[model samples]
Target: MNLIKQYVKEYKNTYIQSVLLAVLGVVSGLAAYIVLAKMIVGLIGKNTEFGFYLQYGLMVLAAMVLKEIFAAASTSISHQATFYSLKKIRQEISKKLFRMPLGNVMNISSGKLKNIIVDQVDSMETILAHIIPEMTANIIGPILLLIYMFILDWRLAIVSLIPLVIGMFCMKSVMASYGKKYQQSVEINQKMNNAVVEYIGGIEVIKMFNQSETSYQKYSEAVHENAAFYYHWMKETMIGVSAYRKISPMSLLTILPLGVYFYLNGSLTIVTFITIIVLSFGTVENILTATNYMDDLSRIGTITKEIGLILDAPDLEHGKENVSLSGSDIELKNVDFSYSEDKKVLEGVSLTIGENQVTAFVGPSGGGKSTITKLIAGFWNADAGEVIIGGKNIKEIPLEQLSETISYVSQDNYLFDMSVRENIRIGKPSASDKEVEEMAKLSGCDEFIRGLSAGYDTIVGEGGGHLSGGEKQRISIARAMLKNAPIVILDEATSYMDT
Candidate 1:
């Protein structure tokens, strides 16, 4: 909720106006109901002629239509608010993920984080779009209904409300039981999302190892759990609906008869008894339905809180003054780092990369060599000591300028589903077709690219699946070459070549 609050603060005025308009629209709509009832009573009393009534009825109909128009306008306004908030949120999360320390980001699932930033924001459309306006109507409509009910027969109005109160109490009990389910379900969804992403990522390995059965079971289990949760959720929803349906209609049945019995004994009038009968349904059902609306609200609250956990996390702190790294020379002094507080991966290890020269880190595996490169790129911050580059601390450098200063090409070269030339453009997005080709040749991809039917324009499969190890490596190097930064860090850059 704090994340949402911060994200939406800029759009608060527009949101307030939309909600106000919605409230007015709902008021106008409920007015039509109350007016129609009064008009009917006038006819029943023979106080107004049919012609006069018809004219007034038409005016009420027109007003109701206008109310609906206001409602539509309110909806459009709310949609804009929701869409803008979502857009800002996605952008913010993207920036935050980019800015956050790489070591910290690595501890969480990328798929789950992706879901939080993208899918979760989209899901919140329900809260900002429908829930707010409906809740306003529900709360306001009931208060008005109760006020009118009081004017009719205070005693019976109070008496007949027992069923509604009972229904509410029962609902509260059910809510208490299931409230935790919302959070539980969210966790399961994140896990399932992570599994699916992992499955897709390692599909090549799975096939190579003949692990079809194992892969299938993983996929099936995630799907099955999601389905089971939904099934139970739907069952619970039905029970709530059924319980209300069973309980609320009886408010009228209970109230009207008792009111009539009073009228028959001369304590009430026929008109008052009739009014109670006609008006009883909305009083009970509207509020009862309002309770359903609350349940939706509670569920949305859960989602917002889940989303909050990520967006509200302490951002990778940056000094107010921008830091600059002047030379390609790299130095880590007494730099200690860890993903967790106690489990340090690089413990007081210091290293240096001489300017404009390749500094290869060789170790069997898991020796924290790649971690060193990540730290150089400001993808992460050292828990202790500074990462000095060109005699300037890298931490003081502005992120955009840092990219202009350093490039890291990891072993697993990543390529977009784009033309051979386009993949190299990431190093310098504005590079011309000629510059891209030149860089590709320099990185040793020119031969393979020229042999392709489409050459530089050939579309690689996702992650460059169409390209072999050496080709992918060259393209990655081409990207680095295009970057032309003063510092280049490579992690297993030539590890899996076909040689």
Candidate 2:
């Protein structure tokens, strides 16, 4: 339901068209089948409808032809709708990640977030395009067919329905119990993602501290847990599928015997009985199709909840009027902050930073220096008091405008997996190649970058793996410098460099 609501919001303009096309396609396909049944039964019967058979045959053929075309059109429209919806949904999620407070986004790691951004969003397209529409078509096609069968013969209608009922019960049991195991699977996957990211990011540290064994153990355990959860889920699913296969067949076999009994007792006609038997195959399929939709509902619901939690996270501060702080000094007055409500990191601590001056935050670890820096940079809001710039409260200033005033260089500089030139271009997007090279030189990155074989055209590895820590830092500083901001707040930017 969450996925559906979000999907509707994302593609509201196309919602009606997609739904209408699906309904039209399903109805036309079923109508084509009905027309054929009527035309065939009409001929060589007590009605003796052979005279108009050719005309009706042509009509049926046209309807059949229309069904194919309409189904294709509907499927195509549905694909487009799903594509657009997923695209917008991913963008919305990215926007939320940008605004969400620290705790919200940090609850999941970069690797998991990467998977969610890339793979999970794509998973929704499968749910929407194939699973959702096919499930709907499967259901609508079966119900209409059953209605037609009932109109022909009620007794066989009842006979054809038994296995469907039982299969549905199987579906309910299978899906309801699935939530626990699937949730476990997700947890294990998240843990594995975190472990892999941590291990890879600190490979040097692991070697330095002789912690490879410990990290490997953690990695193996997380991966093993994920594998075990998937194995369990598959084992359970196999059981259900085997049972469904075993029981769903009973429809045809049971329908024949019971239908014969009804016929022997003069309760049913031969033509009606044959038609019901022919359509009994459709019953088991309808149940299966409904179950498939249930499957999509389950997966989509999980991801939707995850995304919703992120979007609904509490903001650091309620955003207000847009104002730009141009080349202004920063002041923190009577500010207090706490990660936990009860314990304060900064209690009534105040500081001032002059514009264009290199101010260093020097204190022992956990002395709130980093916290103060983050607060001044507006990554977090103070619990009390104000961070003012250019005589305006930081919260009152539009983030982009405040951002325009200050250049930040944080530890663990993240570089996009693009060319060295392209990564630097993020700060001053309009910079010419010559300007980029000049900026790189100013930051001392030009020498190393030019030494690389690919130089500016090189595709950096993920998270800038191609560069060493010093190289990445210089590049980051150069990028920030290219912005030409009046103020720069660098938190632990030189930490990677030995003091």
Candidate 3:
């Protein structure tokens, strides 16, 4: 709720204006009810003057029109503010992810992050754009109507509220364990999402290893678990929910019976009785409309809290200074690092590579060869020692400057879904088309790229899925070659390339 408040504050002017318009709309609706009641009273009293009836009829029509116009305007303004706020929230999350530690980013599965960014963020739109202004209008309108009813006849007004109290009790019972149930639903949904993503992403692997049936079983089990959780939760709450729905709309039962009793006792006038009945219906209707959004409102707090966690995640410490590098000489001084508390990847490691020298670290798998390169590339800070580049501790260099000083091509380089030219240009965004082609030629990919249907402009599918393994590797190499950084670290970069 606080996170929602903060975002609403960002667009306070629009939010305020929308709420004011909604209030105006509700007022218009109440005015229409009043006009209708006046017309009905006149008709019942045998005052069938054509002009009087026509005048009241015109007023009711005008009030109804104004109500619709104001309601539409409020909805339009609220949607604009809601979408813009969501956009800002998404952008903040994206920037936060960029600054966070790579390890932290990797720890969260892609499907879960997608759920937060796409599904969860999108869910807030309905609550923010529609529920906020509309629900406020619904609640306030009923209160105003109830106050007018009390002024008409306080005794009957209290009678009219009996159903509302009962409805509220039912609602409270329904929501007693709503938070826990909703939390369970969210957890189960995320598990299903993760399993679905993993299943689809590993479909090829499953087929190759003849484990498709087992993988499918896992995915189907997750799906069933999610469905069963929701079914049971809804089953548990159905009784209370049904009671609320039945009770909230039954205002007329109390109003009609009590109003007749008062009229029979000579304590209530026909006009006042009619007015109370008309207005009571509107009050109950407004309350019912408001209660319709309770589920959305309840979930708002949970969704925003999840998004806030991402936005408030801690970022790795970085320096702002961009120092000049004398040369590409790299050094590690008694460095120690561990990916986790229980496992040490590198310990008391000290080494130096001279400028213009070719050095290879030959070791068994898991011997920290990749870790050493990542440290030099500033992917992660060493836990116990400093990694020096050109006489300056790597941590002291600004990220942008450090990136410009190194070109790291890993064994599994990812390619964007774009034309070859555009993908290559990512290495040097300002490079001309000619410069990109030259780099592609240098990386031995230009000949194959030229033979494609659109040549350099050919659309490479996601992760270069349309290209062969060797071709994708060459394109990645071309991109890295375009960077032209002072130091190039190739971690099995040519593994996919042909002999």
Candidate 4:
């Protein structure tokens, strides 16, 4: 609720306006109910004038129109606020991801992050846009209408509340383990999503190894588990849910019998009795409508908690100081680091490479060669000691300065789904078309790119899927070359390239 309130606070004025309009709409609806009840009474008494009855009918029509207009206005405002808030949240999440440690970000699976950023965030739309304003109106409108009923006849108002209390008692049973149940359901769904994404991502590997059956079996198992969880949860709660649904709307059961008793015994006038009955019916109907949204309301806490986790993820330490570099000399002094607690990759390592010199680290795989380069480029900080460039500890350098000084291209370079020209221009966003072509030719990819149907303008599929491995490598090389940073770290950068 605090999470939701924080977002609502961002668009406070618009949100308040939406709630106010919704209240007005509810008032208009209740006014129409009152006019209709009076018209019914006038017809029954046989002492009302024809013009008076016609005036009441017209007033009812006017009230109905006002209700719709205000309701639409409220919906429109709330939706605008909700969508904007979602956009802001997504942007913040994106920015936060960049600041967070790469290890921390990777700790969460792609499927889970996708669910949080896209699906879970999207689910809040209905609650914010419709449920918040509409449910508030529905609940408050009934309380106000019930107060009017009490003024008409206090005893009948008290009688009208019996069904509501019974319905709430049943609803409490459904709500008892609702949070736990909902959390379990969400976990199962996330696992299913993860399996689906993993299967699709590894489809080529599965097909190549003929492991489709085993892989598909895992996916099927996940789907079945999710389905079974929901099935059992719903089965368990069905009785309580059904009881609430059946009992909440039966307002007239208590009202009809008790109002008749009061009237027959000369304790209640016919006009007042009929008015109480009609108004009480409207009150319970509003409450029932509001009750229908309880499931969505209950899930808000869980959803916001998930989103909060991402927004609050720990970030890597970054400094504000910007240093001027005289040369691209790189040094590592007593650096010790590990990817995990027990597995130390590098320990007490010391090395130095002079400016304008090429150095190679030749060793067997998993021997900290890539790790050494990544530390120097500030991809990850060493656990102890310092990696220095230009005589200053890399930790003290601003991220922007570090990025500008070093161009690190890894083996698995990612390419966006965009034109060949646009992909290369990512290294230097302001590079002109001629400059892009120059870099592509320098990296030896220009001939192949020209052979394609659209040359540099051709759209590279996701991760350069449409291009060959060597072509992708050349494009990556071209992008790095375009960056023109003083220091370049090529970790297995030439593994896919042909001589």
Cα deviation of 233, candidate 2, in Å:
2.8
| Every candidate's CA RMSD | 2.8, 3.4, 1.9, 1.8
Task: Please provide the root mean square deviation of candidate 1 (C-alpha atoms, Å).
Answer: 2.8
List pairs with backbone clashes in candidate 1: 323-396, 323-397, 327-390
Task: Quantify how close model 2 is to the true structure by its C-alpha RMSD in Å.
Answer: 3.4
Q: Estimate each model's TM-score.
A: 0.90, 0.88, 0.95, 0.95
What is each predicted model's overall lDDT from 0 to 1? 0.77, 0.75, 0.88, 0.89
- lDDT per residue as tens, model 1, 138-238: 67876887788788789887867878876776566567756588777777888789889889988989999999789979988998998899888878767
Candidate 1 similarity to native, TM-score:
0.90
- Give one digit per residue, the lDDT tens place, for model 4 in 266-298: 999999988887887778777888888888888
Q: What is the lDDT of residue 100 in candidate 1?
A: 70
The 10-residue segment with the lowest total lDDT in model 3: 176-185
| Candidate 2 backbone collisions, by pair | none
Worst 10-residue lDDT window for candidate 2 reads 35-44
Query: What is the C-alpha lDDT profile of model 3 across 286-377, one tens digit per residue?
Result: 88888898888778767977787687777766678788778999999999999999999999999999998888989999999999998898
State the displacement of the C-alpha of residue 315, model 3, in Å, after optimal TM-score superposition.
Answer: 0.9
* Global lDDT of model 3: 0.88
| Position 245, candidate 3: lDDT | 86
Q: Give the TM-score of candidate 4.
A: 0.95
